[model samples]
Target: MKKSLLFLFGLFSLWSFALINFKGVPVFSIVEAQQKTQPLTGKKVKTEKPVTIKRNAVTTVLPVAQYPLPKGSQWSYLDNGSDQGATGWNQLTFDNSAWAAGAAPLGYGDPVATTISYGPSSTNKYITSYFSRDIQIDLNTIGDEVEFGLRRDDGAIVYVNGVEVFRNNMPAGTVNYLTNSASIVDGADEKRYFTTYLPKSVFQNGVNRVSVEIHNRDQTSSDISFDMYIRDKAPDYVCVEDHIACFTSIAPTSQTPVMIIPQEHRFQMLFKQGTAYMDGSGTVPGNHDFTGYIPSVGATSSALGHLSVNHENNPGGVSIVDIALNQDPANPLWVVNNSRKVDFSNTALVKTERNCSGGVTPWGTIITAEEATTSGDSNGDGYQDVGWLVEINPATASVVNYGNGTHEKLWAMGRMNHENIVVSADGVTAYYGEDGGTHCTYKFVANTPNNFSSGTLYVLKMDLALSNDEPSSATATWVQVPNTTQAERNNVTTAAAALGGTNFNGVEDCEISPIDGKIYFASKGKNRVYRFKDNGTTVSEFETFVGGKSYPITTANGVVTENWADGNDNLAFDDHGNLWVVQDGGLNYIWVVRPNHTQSDPKVMIHSSMPAGSEPTGLTFTPDYKYGFFSVQHPSGSNQAQPDATQSNVIFNASAALVFSNKDFLGQQQNLSTNPVVALNSEIQVYPNPTKGLVTLSLNEEADKNLKIEVYDFLGRKVYAKETQTTGINQKETIDLSGFKGEQLVIIQVETGDTKQIYKVLKKDN
Candidate 1:
């Protein structure tokens, strides 16, 4: 059965990527002709757009009451030969292909998803849960008590014969989280069961089936570690494997994020939990200018959560990455100048012209996907032949290149259009999702398992769950990676088969929550996020985002109308147990989802004006939840001939970096001022101060978007011009400054978007 909730998000004009055909009905709210406020007079300011998204819930069979072993009946979990069902607890390190394939009846990828499960037949067997035909252990041989140890991080249920003996009733993490990303990987699921003190007759003289259902939440998050055995009875059993390891028992690893700065100064809290500081001396330029940053140090999310990006659709400014300084909820955030400005030039990775997606690595590095292959040759080349993942150094502002430094080499992973890279907490596994044809989900086990570049990649055959599909809803089953030519993996047919079926509307963004470690990826066109059970064969669907919030708004005295469509681009968990994501719709806004709502919906962390006037694109949390970064691509779309082009700058009005603190919308801005450079007095020249047509401005070639432009008359009446654009280092702008011409002294100011820009333009005597 299909059940969904509600979520709401607005829009942001960013990324020329993912060609969007808004169906002409681009859901947005035009800034009505209202009176203007300070700094923005006469021009329409796109306000918030109220919208609602449906939360689709996947109805699955809940846990049922289990009975005791029956007389002369078959039980589960037998340790005969061939590694039969319910093999109590065994280290699953070698030959995963065999175990994953052998445990077919137990299920693999979620049955309701388009995931691939390996086993005897597509009809049965998935290695997610191992059900057995019971094994008889001599009760007298027992030390007195029986114990089943487990390290399941998500959900694990055990049953004897058809009777449920043990249940890890850990409720699933709430869905529809908008803010407060949890810090640290989801804890491992290690549990133990015991019956040593029970009467020997509890183990009857017959066999039993040790049926177990283990939900992984997500691949990287699945930590199934346990040892089941009869131990000496009494509290002393703690000495046994069951309760052997506590927080102190587990080996903890320490990590530190990389940050390089040419000049040192105070750090600014962009998002929160961490702070990024830079010396404004000669090293930094403007809002988008910085040598490097000091990342907020803290624990990581419970699972793979986020990716950072910068949108550059300039000239109009539909996207503006806002990094609030205040992250604490109880703390009062005081605004300051902690905002760091960035553009495409200083950071070439953000300016990539090819089809690229971002993912985090096990080593706190950025991994970008090279989705463009030889096929889409814009110049009509025979073959571009370029599809691989690129590594980026966030601390050094550097990109990983080939050993020779001449070309950037791809990682061991094969060439394909990757959607997400869900990294594990222990830095051992990386799950990459390739969307296109038959979708392929690949696992990179760094634990020396299998060969390098060749562990095991499975195709999700969502068709296997047809038995559970309801007549009223659409459903599919999952299977293993189809044994086919590697070429098929790159083609569309294989991707479809691999991801269950070709019935997907459009699958995109994939993320794992930090609190629960559940893997979530969406079929953009389908507007759904699927939660794959650890047993790998089960799947569930949830909905909670579309437009604004779940509630509808009535204009003044008008009736209430609901609009849903929260363009979920990507999602990430923060250090403070919050979910952060960027929405792409006509209404641009950044959203922060709370952890546990009734239906698990995302709370609006910060909702800004619509894209018609501003921008807030994709977001990524820093190592520590202290500071986060967001990309503000173009914000307006008045110039693009084809409004649907992925790289069009139609919604770019102006771009600036916004900083927050304590995760508060009104967080205090950190001191961003560095050692001031020699402010040039007569070096810059901007022309046509009061031209009725077009006006052009030029900078020192190295100056950045810090050059702000504004016009004023003798009476101190300010007129609106346009903010310049940034690329590489310098800044420039050409605006139709015609509307404001009845001025005596054409006072032009040029400075950072915050500080007053210096200007001195003499009015021409017509």
Candidate 2:
């Protein structure tokens, strides 16, 4: 005969049973156990396999509970500056009825709910302050571990149930009331919270006493602060995939449009405003605007790079973040390795303001545009120097030095309400637009290739008058502007108008088509995106590429008809020549226009709609085109949380930077069939023409034989040569041109078996 022994665990009673013989020996079974559902909670409980155990064996484990000590909780503190020594004042049995009670955080100097006395004199303040709180705990309902969130200045020591549990900033060995902190606490570290974990065994079954002693670095320390909270050591958020629709028919009015994406894609938040940096600096700034991604040198992984994010404020700042991909294959995630604020005060410009959209140079540097002009001249450079383009080294989070004791503001770029700038592949020409009410599109040609210190500025002058309300076309010439003097550069808008420069209403962004090498810019006030073919001196075939007309948008719900509203702001291109338009006005939608889109029959799709009271800005892609980054600027505080259920309690309601990509799109080569620049013969291609320091040679799949690449300068002098076997796919070979000087023409020859191709490339000095 056999007897059954049963056991139930915790509040969510899970049942398990074992069979025992009459002689008291347990019998194990391998049969599958069934699951039972609790009617009250509607939660399923899974049973474990029957095992051999004692007849009266029992086990208890409970789920983690909510935080026990919240901010501003009342605490009994002693601030009389007397040494309590090792007298059992921290024990539960100790009498503390005479101690003064106050709501935390309680200290001096910084903002606090309750301020405590700092002792006799300002020069001779007290060294330590004592704080204690009582909390009840149940052994059967508590978790295995607890975490303490402590905010202290200088140092602190914590005790649980009259036993030492953690020490921070204090010296090693026996600690007493006279102990001093290891170092001084200053700046942002004073307000930062430090966390520590301890086993729940330190707590008691009934009432538990928690005591903490905060010590200053020295007796004369100017400031002191203390606050603490306790919670179970379990993560509040459980990561889950957000499965949203690919498209929605509802427009954003009272609330933000629901984020929809392709079924295979995933969206993730990389950084949020007000998050503390890993280096103990202040939290990330708000009003996130321009986001630029710079891939690390020689980085084999597509996800390893640096991000330069601009804060659009009165005194603007740029934050540089070093990021990498996590190792989890099932759930790939991007992690921030380090982050800090870019130091612009060390430069001659002192500080930047209203940093809007920017561009990345081919030689690895970021150029941030100052979108506003100010009357104050911090640099005293005869004219207001706040509206020039500034360059930065994202890797070091510092402004580039010109080696002349000055810093990275390009004075030659002229002063205006700059919206965005785009550099050509050759690194010689740059196009930017003015975002004022009546402004003109401008161009810059560097005198020394990649060096933008001194450049010639020009404004667009169209031969035919272009219509602002309907589809129109025209030819234009770049008229040279008198930008040599500070006074002339200060008033470029007025001078350009005098020279008959075509006035565009709110020209917001400029981008070069990677497929056909054409220039495209968006006029926000006119609601049109105009494209132009750049010939050496003049532009031809200038016409409206998108907007200024009605188009059909396909969605998962159904086909929807819409017209371009007054919102087209920023523009970016993908590997497939698809244009991604980020909006700052109207419905604040992110629109994607295919390469084959025509004026009569446009192929456009709505990708995303920003949250209420917010506009999407700064959309940039990685080198492999596998990931994209953008910012949601100043979203409504009441907007719904995203991705996870616990996010509702988090701070994503503020501004944030996000990254999105699909697993199927990673590690794929560029599509050469649709790109005219790379599909001439579907064989070999050399770019960027007019090399600065290095040039890349790309070979197609048909080039499977032994490949020979040779570069010759003017007068037929062999400058560089290499021979290797081709992988027959998207194989790239880099040719170094740093040895050459000045601007000169060079011929790059590629021979694969019998097929040979020669490209006339211009090699420019760095």
Candidate 3:
């Protein structure tokens, strides 16, 4: 499945003023003052020997302890000079009585409370350390949730009741004492806090053992820090399964063109989200040259009374534009007018980079994401830029500043290679996905609805081992991470890794179901889309909806003929509960899957297709479901655009905005008598007459009835014959003359009962 945001804080230190707050949950401290503290004392469990408790000198700080520290939340340690062979070190039954007892803040570097448990030993170089402790679990009085506050200088893996639960700053796969940690943890001077949450499912009726193994960056590492605190509270909400969706089977249609954007029209729209502001300073109202573009989001409706399009450009900057659209339901087409560029560069988006795909907020705004985690200091903010969720006000055509910096970065939402952001109907809880390998899914809970300025971010950790099945999973846990400032926010990825967030295969676009309130997200690299249940505070019921190795298909020359789609990028939901998915890879196709579709009655359909070398992006619908907007990006140049003879007056290319009328998408047709063809010969036309192998025959709606088509060589040999129905006016049918060798002329005949006609055409060799 996919994973989800939060900010950064200064390194973990004993400074009294360094205290931070989340809603009312104070940042747990290992060096709180006033001496109003207790030792690790609680119901003792079975061990070889009694547990030893240590008391250190306490400092006089402030009254910030909102929740009393849990008993036995501290740990005892042992330094590993070399590889400690596989043993029961993580189990409650493991005999660690011989280990030394020391209060937390146990390491050589940084400010500590009691003792330096390891390191600073020049000769006896220690590379890894071990820690274990036991905490009482009173099922009757304890809550269903547990939160942990940890500080590790390098990396560590945590366990509860002998079960391995979380790992941070560590490599994947089996790890041992000799195994070195991942990259050096980010920060200077002090250990940083890495927080996470665990459900009551990890606990039992009695005493549970908490164990940890801390690994150093290298043998010469000067510091190694480790500390933890735990508390239990009732879960805010629970998830129950309602409906599970599966990727519906779809048949790819050939050359069924919808719309096209030519290279000439690219300048009309802005570049991708971040690329527009590349030079650093450009007035919003000024017109400029544009080469290529990517569309990220599209919104339209009568309530909004206009159309909004998002440009997803990385090298320049992202932008949104407001346009007035005129559509005729009877004609099944629309036109763009009164286009106005949204001022993203002048406002908060001046620093946006790789502003990729995003989702629309319920409050009639767009939540554009900066796909780059490390955008250089674009705004000269001292801090490196990019990697943020920016809110845009479509109505005013500007960034939405909620007292934060321009283009509210939602710094409280943490930083990562953000792919998409979907807010809950309540507007307080938001779900996001990261677009990189081995990333985590996250959720942010605001202090109040529609006010995301301050909130708590949590990373999702699933118990996948509990069930081997890939899809239909219903269990996962959320761990809170710090998100108080921009710098702190930038450390979210590292914090989430430490919190044991599940590794996903490049999580992308996330959307919430209005019918069921479930959140759906895509793992593009894995070729699967997944959904989960969110209860505002905590989320559960994570499972894959569809797409995997099981759905087999192949792409040749920008065309896919299979009944499945891969590389699912953006997603949109129409009022009818139909999910429209936009593909990213070469075979740019838009697939529509019905919510209640089943195997016996498959309801998946190919809604549209982008031209060769392009992908359909920014799929969205108006509030009234009357019109849907999308963009076709990056059409290849050397190759011919090769318009579908079936579509009328369409140009598909880079950074082009297009729309589909709800009626046209539903296969509805206008009154045939209103626009009829009197003579078949006069209404029919052939394109590129002297063609190589392929040629198109465009027919008007009068040819809607079954017609017999035949082709003959110069020698009077019948080469081909077929009967088919015309879909609409200007319907195109491609005929291949490749098999007719040594032929310079061919006879083509069309016959439908009383109407029969023959025409001579020239065939050329490649």
Q: How well is each residue in 19-136 modelled by candidate 3, as lDDT tens digits? A: 2222232433322321223222222321122223322321221121223233222365766464554777778777665455544556675434334445556644577888777666
Off by over 4 Å in 2: 1-258, 299-301, 468-472, 644-651, 663-766
- The CA lDDT of each predicted structure is 0.35, 0.71, 0.57
RMSD of each: 29.1, 30.8, 21.4
Q: Using lDDT as the measure, name the better of candidate 1 and candidate 3.
A: 3
Q: How far is candidate 3 from the true structure (C-alpha RMSD, Å)?
A: 21.4
In candidate 1, what residue range of length 10 has the lowest lDDT sum?
237-246
> Highest TM-score: which candidate?
2
Winner on TM-score (1 vs 2): 2
Model 2 residue 676 distance off true place after TM-score fit, in angstroms: 35
Candidate 3: which stretches are off by over 4 Å? 1-306, 325-333, 344-350, 375-383, 404-407, 465-473, 536-538, 549-565, 598-603, 638-648, 662-766
Pairs clashing within candidate 2: none
| Quality of model 1 by C-alpha lDDT | 0.35
| Candidate closer to the true structure by TM-score (higher is better), 2 or 3 | 2
User: lDDT tens string, model 2, 436-473?
Assistant: 83468999999988888788989998754553343222
Off by over 4 Å in 1: 1-352, 374-384, 401-412, 432-455, 463-503, 536-563, 598-609, 613-615, 637-652, 655-657, 663-766
